[model samples]
Target: MKGKWHSSWLLLLIAVVLVLSACSSGNNSSSSADNKEEATSSGEPQDGGELKVGLSANPKTLDPILYTGVYESQIMRQVADTLVVYNKELSDFIPSLAKEWKVSEDMKVYTFTLRDDVYFQPGEYQDGRQMTAEDVKYSLERSAKESAMNRLRGVEKVEVTGEFEVEVHIGTPNAALLAMLTDSGNIIVPKEEVEGWGDQFGSHLVGTGPFQIKDWQKDSEVKLTRHDKYWGEKPHLDGVSFKIISDPNMMTNALRSGDLDVGTDIKGQNRELIKTDQNLELLSKPALSLTYLDLNNKKGPTADPKVREAIYKATNVEEIVKGVNQWGGAEPSFMGLPKQSWGYSKDLEKLKPTFDPEAAKKLLAEAGYPDGFKTELYLSEARVPYGTIFQNQMKENLNVDVELKVVEWGTYSDTVAKGNAPMSIGGWTWYPDPYFFLYQLFHTDQIGALGNGKGYSNPEVDSLLERAVSETVDQNERAKLYQQALEIILKDVPRIELDNLEASAGINKKVQGYDVSSDFSIIIVSPNGTNVWMKQ
Candidate 1:
C-alpha cells in the first residue's frame, strides 16, 4: 500500500511540472510578438546613412549675425538653432527653444518660457549640457554688444527668472522686434564658450542643435555628425557633408549622379533642368528676399533723386525676372520688399514701375544723360543665385552701355567695406519684420560708404519708425505704419528694384524632406532633431 501511494504522489508532481511549462511558453510568445511590432513601427533600417550636398561657394564667415544673405546663413543654420524659427510656410515665426512667449502690456518686454527638455550638441570635453535660462540671457546680451546693428539694441536687459525662463525687457516697444529675433543672425549661442571669440567664433561653432561640427576642410567640405545625446529626436542620417562646388551646372550633375542629397541657392537654366528630372525632386518656395541694385546716394549720378528714378525706370527688372531666370515664380520687385511681407502697403500697387523706356529716355535727357551715361556696374562673382548670368542679362536688357567690373565675393566684401564698389547688385533676406528693409538699410546708425551703401536717411521715416517702435500694440496697425513707410522708400527709389527671386533647389530622390525658402534657412526643415534621416 505504501509503494502504491508514493507512485501516485510522483505522478501528481509530474502533472504540475507540465502545466508550468505551458504557461512559460505562452509568455515567451507574447513578448516576441510585441518586439516585432515595435521594430516595424520604428522604421529602423539595418544601417544609418549620410547626406552629401553641393554648395555654391565656401562660406567666408560662420559668424551667424555678422554675415548677411543666403550662403553664410545656410552654413550657420546646420550648426545652430535660433530661439524663434520661421515656419515652413513662411507665414510667421514659430516657437523653437522658447516654446511660448508673451509681450508686456506696454509691449516693451518679451518674456520667453523655454521647453524643459533641451540639450546642447555633444562635445569632446563634456557629454552635453541641459539648456538653461542663463543660456538665453547669454545669447542676447553678447549678441547686442557684439555688433553696432543688433536688433537687441532696443532691448534694455535680459534676465533669467528660473531654470527655464528668460525675460527680454526692451527700452521701448517695437512691433517688428520679435520678428527680427527669428533670424539666424540673432541665434542664441552657448555663453560660456562665446564670451571672447568675437568674429573668430564663426570658425568654432557650438549650439544645442541636432548635429555637432566634426571636421572642416575649408573650401572642400563641411562635415557634421549626428548627436545621439540630442534632446530631441535623433537624425536618421548618421552624418551630413557640404561639398563646395560653385558652378550651378556641376551642382546639378552631383544631384543627378546620386552623389549629392541637397543643393542651395539654385537658379537660372539649371532650375529648369532640376525640375524636369525624373530621378530627383524639386523643393522651391518664395523666400522673404528681394534683389536690388544698391545705388550709392553718397556719390555719383545716383545722388540725384531723378537719376535714381530714371535708373529705376530704365533698368528692365521684369525682363530679368522672366528671361534671365528660366524658372517661373520670380516677379519684378515693385516695393522695397516682396508683397507677401508685413508692412507691405498695397499703396505700392497703386503706384507703378512699368516698362516705360521712352519715359526713361526722356527722364535721362532731363537728368543730363541724354546720350546715356558711361558707368561700370560692379558685379559679384559670388555664384549666388546666378550673379554672373543676371549681370550679363541686365547689361544687355538696359539698352545702355554699362561696363561690368566683376570681382570675387571675398575681395568684393572687403572692397565694398572700403567704399570702393560704385554700384553693385545687393540683396536683403527679408524676415518676418518690415523694419529689416526700412530700418537696417536706411538707419543713421548704419549709414556708411560701406554698410549703408544706399545712404538713404529721412527724418520722417525715422519718426514713423520710432513711433512704430515705441507705441504700437497691434501687429496689423504696425503693418499699416510700415506701409506708410514703404510708400516713402519706393517713391525715393534709392534702389533699382530688381527681381523678387523665387528660391529654387535640386534634391536627390533620397532626401525625403527638403525645401528652399526666402529666408534661405534650410535648418527649418531639419529642426533641432526631426527632419533628417535615412530612408532605408
Candidate 2:
C-alpha cells in the first residue's frame, strides 16, 4: 500500500484555480442566469415560443418504472409531476402534486393531501381527468412493486384514505422516501394510461405537469407541448423540443447555429467555444454526480477479488480525470459520493486506495495471472475518451490489454445490467441524499438495473444501509451510517471512481430564467411557472 495523497487539499486548490481562471476570462460562463444579460428582462416574460434543447443520447423509455438512464429522466421530468420537488437550494422539499404531507413519529407512515386541481394531460387512455388520492396510491404502489430503479424499496402499502388524502406505509422508517420520490421512477402515473398502453405506455405518456408529451420521434426528438388544463400556472413557453444529438460536436454546432436553445453535457473544447461565443452563455455547476469504472465481481477475470484490487492499484485515477475533463468540469474522486453531498466526509477520503503499479503486478501474479490478462471495457460513445485513457493506462502500467467496446447508450446499460460487461465506465447523478447514492448503488437488493449492476453484495454494507434509512431520522446519524457503509464499499474495490462531475451546458442567451442544478435537472421551472421564458 502507498501513503496517503492530499487529494482533498488538491481539490480545494483546483477549485481556486478554476475560480481565478474564470475571473480572468471576463465574459465567462456562470452558474447563475443573473450573470448573463436577458434581452427583454424589463417586459413580462414572453410565451408561445418552442425551446429546443439537445440531449447527449436517446432515451430508452418514457415509463418511469422502466427508464434507467439520465437521458430518459431528463425528458420525463418535464412531463411528470412528483408528489414533491427539491427546493432550489436542495435543502428541503416543496409541494408539487401533494399540497401538504404529514409523517408519523416512527417515520413509517406518511399521509399526503393531494392537490384536487391537478389533471393528467389528454391521452388516448382518457381525456384529461382530475388527479386524486387514488392516483398517488397507484403511482407509489406501482413504483414500489415494479420500478426498474427500485425507487420505493421499503414501501409496504399505499392506501387511499380520502378523496384527496392517501397514506403510505413503509415496512421500515424510511428517511430517503421523499428523496426517492423526487426521482423519475416514482412520478405519479394514471392507471388508465399505464393499463391502456401496456407495453407502449412510455411511448404515449400522460402526466399532470405544465408540459405534456406531444410527439416522440424515436432517436430523433421528443416534442412536448403546454398542458392547457394544468393545475399550476401555465408555462411561459408553448413547448420544449428535446433533440437527440449523440455527438458532442453536433450538439455544439446546433447551439451555435441557433437550432438548439440549450446543449447539455458540454465538455472539453466545446465549453471553451461556448464561453468565447458572444451569442451563447455557459451554465455550469459542481454536480452531485459520480463517474466510475465498475469491475464486475461475478464475471470472468474480474471475479477474482485480487484482480479487482490489482486493477484499482494499477489505475492513476487523477491522471485519467485530468485527461478527460481538460476544461475543469470534473474532480478526481476515490469513492461514489460527491464532495458537494452532505454525507461526504474527510474520514472517508482517508481510505482512498493508493496507486502502486508494482503492487498491482504482484497481486496479478499472485492471482494466477503472471501474464497480464485481456478484458473488454464496455461504454457509451460519449465515454470513449474515458475508455481510451483507461485503456492506455492499463496497458502501460499493468501490461493488461483492454478492448474498448463502444455500444449505444441503451444497449450499454442493458449489457452491464446483465453482468456481461467485465469492465465498464458509467456515471450516476441524483439528489444530495446519501441514500440516493450509496444505498441504490451498493445495496444487495439493488442488483441489476436497479443500480448494483456490478453484481456486488455485502451483508455488512446492506445492514448499514437499512439502518441508515429506517433506524434514524436524524441527518447527522444517517450521514454517519452512510459514511461507514461507503468506507466498506471502497475497500471492496467494486469500482474505481473517476470523478465528481461538474455539469456544464451551453445556452442561447435569449433563453432566460435558467439555473444550473447539481442533480442534472437542468430545466428549473418555478411552481408559479414564471421561469424558463424565451426572450422576445
Candidate 3:
C-alpha cells in the first residue's frame, strides 16, 4: 500500500513539471516576438541596406588629387581618407589617416605618425597593401605638380622618417598648411596603384576608406560598396549609389517618389515643396560661399575704382536677396568673406556701402561715364535671377543698360577663369581660414585659372595677406590682419558683394544619421557613411 502511494505521488510530480516547462517555453517565444516587433516599430538601425543619393551635377573626377569641384570632393571623400579632418562643427581639427601629429617650434615642419591597422581596399593594383609613410610621401609629391594648382607651394619636401612616420618640411611657417591638408584633395592613396594606373588613376581608386568604388558611369551614376576591411567602425549600409540628376526639379521629385534616399543642392523654388512634403526632411544651412558681381579690374569701364564704387552704391543688395532667395535665403554681404568665417569682422557695417542712386550717379560722372555704359553680364542658368535683378537695379538707379548672357556652367567657369568676362555674376566657396578668402581671391598671383578671376590686386592687400599667412600663429592676430585686408578690398570695390548664400537639401524620411554642414559641403559632415545608417 505504501509503494503504490509513492508511485502515485511521483506520477503527479512528473505531470506538474511537464506543464510548467510548456508554460515557460510559450512565454519565452512571446517575449522574443514582442522584442522584434518593438525593434521594427521603433525605427532601430539595421545592417545591410542601400542608400540612393541624387546629385545636381556629375562628379568630374574620382581622383582626389585632381578633383576641384564640390561634388567631386563629396564622392572622393568616401573612397579616400585625408590625413586630418574637421570636427563636426568644423571648429577644430581631428585625426583621420594620421593617428597623431606634432609640429616643430618654428612651425615649418609637421610630423605625422601613421596607423598600423590601416589597409587599402582590395583592387587590381592593391592586394590589401598596408598603408605606410612611403605612400604619404608619394601622394604629396605627386600633388605638387603645376596641374594640381601648386597645392604644396610652400612645402620644401616630404620625407619618410620611419616605417610608419613622415615629416613634412616647408619653406616658411605656413598657418594654412594644416587647414589645407584637411581638404579632400590631400587624401592619401596607394603609391604602387597610382603608378600602375598612370593617367587612368582617376577611374581606379584604391584607398583605406569606408567605401570602395564598384562601378562608375559618367554623367549617370556611381556605385560603391562597403569596405569590410576598414579600420574604423563598419558602415551600417551595404552600399551607396550616387545618381546624377542635373535638374533640381527631377531630384526633388525623385526624393518624394521614394526613388532617392537623399537629394542635394535643392534650389530655392523647390524648398517650399520639400518642406511641405510629409515624407521628406528639409535641411538648410548658411553656406560658406559668397555670391557677387565681379567686375574685371584688368580692363573695361570697371577698371576705374570710381566706376566699381559707383556700381557698388547703385545696386540694391537687400532687394535681390529677398526677391531671388525666397525660401532658403541669404544675408546681404559687404565683403568677400562670409560672416560665418572665423576672421569676419563685426565692424564691417561701418565700411558697408549703402544704396544711394545720387551718390552712384555722381561717382559715375566723376569716372567719365555720366550717361552710364552698356555691358554684358555673363551668368549661368542657376544665377540668371540674380543677374536679372542686378541689371534692373543698375538700369533704374545708374541709367546703365546691361545685357544678360546666359551660358552653360562649363563655359561660364572657363570664361571666368580666362578673365574674359568684363562683368559677371560669380561665386566662390572659401575655406575655413580667412587667409584663404583674402589670398585666393584678391592676390595678384591667382589671376587666371584658380582664383582672382576679376584680376583685382592691390599692393597693400597683397602685403597684408602675405603677412596673415606667414607672419602669425595667433588666430586673433591673423583676424586683425584679415580685417585690415578686407577694409582695403571694400574701399577698392573690385567685386560688389551681393550676399552670403544659403544651401538646402531634401532628405527622405527613410534615411537617418545625416546632418547638413554650415559650409554647405555634405562631405564636411560625413566624408564617409560610417556614422550614417538607413532605417529597415
Candidate 4:
C-alpha cells in the first residue's frame, strides 16, 4: 500500500510540470507573433527623433576656409557641400555638388557641370537662391588666401563658362587636383552671404547641405535643423544637437547614461567599458592620420641630425602603442604617410629606426649632448598621455629630460604655428594622395603656418614632390617618385613617426545607420543622417 501511494505522488508532480511547460511555450509563440505583426505593419524605417552628439571640443571657427582642425570640419560638413567626396573605402571619389566633370587631354583644365537642383539654405542673407557656377568660382577664389590654398598651387584661373558650368585652368597638370577639390575648404558658399557677413562670416555659416545651423554658442553647444529642400533624400531626424564635452570620462558617462546618442574621441579604458554595455555600440575605423613628435630643425639641440636620429632610435614605439592600446589598433611606423595610402612603400621598412640604446648614446655624444639636455615638449591636453610616454622613454633610454607643457587645443595650435615649442607632439590628416602627404608637410614653401610646422626643408624632397604632382600622371610613376622623396625625408628625421590612429565613437543602440570612415571625416558618417533612424 505504501509503495503505491509514493508512485501516485510522483505521477502527480510530473503531470503538473508538463502542464507548466506547455503554458510557457504557448506564451512565447504569442509574443513572437505579435512582434512580427508590429514590424510588418510599421515598415523598416521609423523617423522623427533628435540625435544628440557629444563632441570632444568646440569648433574654433565654422568658416570652412579658416578652420583647420577636425572639430571644426565636423560642424562645417553639416552646413557645406563639397565638389567630390570619398567612397566608403576612401580609395575612390564620388560626385557631390558637381554632377559630372571633364578633363582636358593634357589634364591641365577641368570643366565641372554644377547641378541646378541644389539650393542654398534659406537664411537672413540668402533667399533660397540656387547655387550656380559663379558661386563656385567665387568660393574658390575667396579661399585662395587661406592655408588651404596650398592644394590649389598650380591653378592659374577659375572661369565661369556657362550658367551651370565652370572651368578651372592649371598652369601644370596636377595629379591631386580632383582630390584637392574634395576638401571641405572648397565648399561652395553663396556670394551674397559672404559679402554681407564679411569678418563675422565664420560665426554665421551659410551653404547648401542637408542641415543648417540654427543656433551656435561658443564653448557650449550647436543646434542644427534639417533642410527640407535638400537636393538629396530628406534627413530622417528632425534635428541634431552637438554638445561640447572635453573630458573623456564625462563624455563616456553621458553616452552610457543615454544623454548622448553618439560621442567622438572616446579613448583608453572607456572604449572597453562601452563595448561591454548591452545598450551601446562602438564604431571604429583605421584612420589615415598620424601622430608624431615634431622636432624643431631650425634651432636648439634637435636641429642636429644626429640628435634627431638618437631620439628616434632610443624611443620604443611598441611601448607607446601599448600605452594607447584602447585608442586604436595602432602599430609603429617610420614614414609620414599611412600604411594603406596609395603611394606608401613597403621597401621603406628596411630603413626604419630600431631600438638601440648604445647607438643612441653614441649619437647623442656626437651631437655635443653627452650629458643630455632639457627641452619643453608642447602637447594638447587631450593627447598628454602620448607625450608623457615619449618623454619617459627619452629620459630612460637617451638620458634626455623632456618637460611637458600641456595646453588647450587652441593655444597649442597657435604655439606650434609660431614655431615656439622646441619639441612638440603634433599630427596631420593629409588628403588621400601622396602629393598632400609630401608637398603640404615637407615642402619648403609650406614652412610657415601651413602643415610644415617643423621648419624642416630639403630641396631634393621638394623637387621630387613637384615632379610627382606636375609631371607624373601615372599612378605607378607617381608612387615611385614619392618613395624616393620619402627615403630622403626619413634620412633627415625631422619628425618621429609614432602610429596611425583609429577614430572611434560610442553610440547608443537606439541609433542606426551610423558608421565611421577610414579617412576620419565626420561628414562621411552617413552624411546628413538621411538613412539614419531611431527606435522608440
Candidate of highest TM-score: 3
For candidate 2, lDDT tens digit of each residue in 1-536?
12235777778899999998877676445523443335255655766699999999999799999998888988888888899888876767889888898889899898898888888888887888888888889998999999877878889999999999999999878898888888888888899999999999989878887789888899999999988887877788899999999999999999999999999999889999999999999998888998999989888878888999999889998888888888878888868898878888977786777999999999999999878989999998988989998899899888899999999988888988887888989888778998888877888887876367899999999999999988767778998999889888888889888888887889999888876778888564656233688885
Which predicted model would earn the best lDDT?
2
For model 3 the TM-score comes to: 0.87
Tens-place lDDT per residue, model 3, 67-173, is 76788777787888888877766656778888899888888888999888889998787698888999898887677553264556677789999998999898888
Question: What 10-residue stretch in candidate 3 is worst by lDDT?
Answer: 521-530
Name the candidate, 1 or 3, with the larger TM-score value. 3
Residue 525 of model 4 has an lDDT of 29
The runs of at least 3 residues in candidate 3 whose Cα sits more than 4 Å from the true structure, single-residue gaps closed, are: 1-45, 146-149, 296-304, 362-370, 405-422, 447-450, 523-530
Answer with 3 or 4, whichever has the higher TM-score.
Answer: 3
Q: All candidates' lDDT scores?
A: 0.69, 0.86, 0.82, 0.82
Please say which candidate is ahead in lDDT: 1 or 4. Answer: 4
Clashing pairs in 2: none
Between candidates 2 and 3, the one scoring higher on lDDT is 2
Whole-structure CA lDDT of model 4: 0.82
Please state the error at residue 1 of candidate 2 in Å: 99
Between the candidate structures 3 and 4, which one is better when assessed by lDDT?
3
For each candidate in turn, the TM-score is 0.76, 0.77, 0.87, 0.80
- The global Cα lDDT (0 to 1) of model 1 is 0.69
Candidate 2 residue spans exceeding 4 A from truth: 1-48, 58-61, 66-69, 122-128, 145-151, 189-204, 213-222, 295-314, 354-384, 391-426, 444-460, 491-494, 528-530
